[model samples]
Target: MPWQHKIAYLIGKPVGISLSNGQGTSGILCDVSNGKLLVLEYLYQSQFALKQYDFHMIQDINGFPPCMSQRLY
Candidate 1:
């Protein structure tokens, strides 16, 4: 299976997404299928919305409480 399919296991979990356009967004990973990503973004108190993104536009993906692979110091 492709790496994207592996992300399906993280469904319902919050994640940070980096886009090819140099933009970034974080949200709950709702679903991933057919080269599409469904994210649930929090707009405000008691308000939320779902956004769809093309899988191809994604540059990187990281989960919350990010961990560094290398020492910064």
Candidate 2:
């Protein structure tokens, strides 16, 4: 399995996602399948519906409490 497949285990858990475009968001990993990702909601999104994004856009998974990562700058 690829790294993304392993990350699928995060389902139902909160994780920080850094996109290739340098944008970031945190949400519950609701689903990861068929080249798509379904998150419960981004950190700044107020609606409770799941949001979808292309799996390829995901650059990294910053784990829970994502702020633990060292600053890149």
* Maximum-lDDT candidate: 1
Residues 1-73, candidate 1, lDDT per residue (tens digit)? 4447557676888998889999999999998877888999999989999999998898877778866789878
lDDT of 2 by residue, 1-73 (tens): 3447557578788888889899988888888778888888744556576888797898877458546667789
Candidate that scores best on TM-score: 1
> What are the clashing pairs of model 1?
none
- Model 1 bad stretches (over 4 Å): 1-6, 66-73
Please give the CA lDDT of all the candidate structures: 0.85, 0.77
For each of the candidates, give the backbone clash count.
0, 0
Colliding residue pairs in candidate 2: none
TM-score of each: 0.76, 0.70
Residue 46, candidate 2: C-alpha displacement in angstroms: 6.7
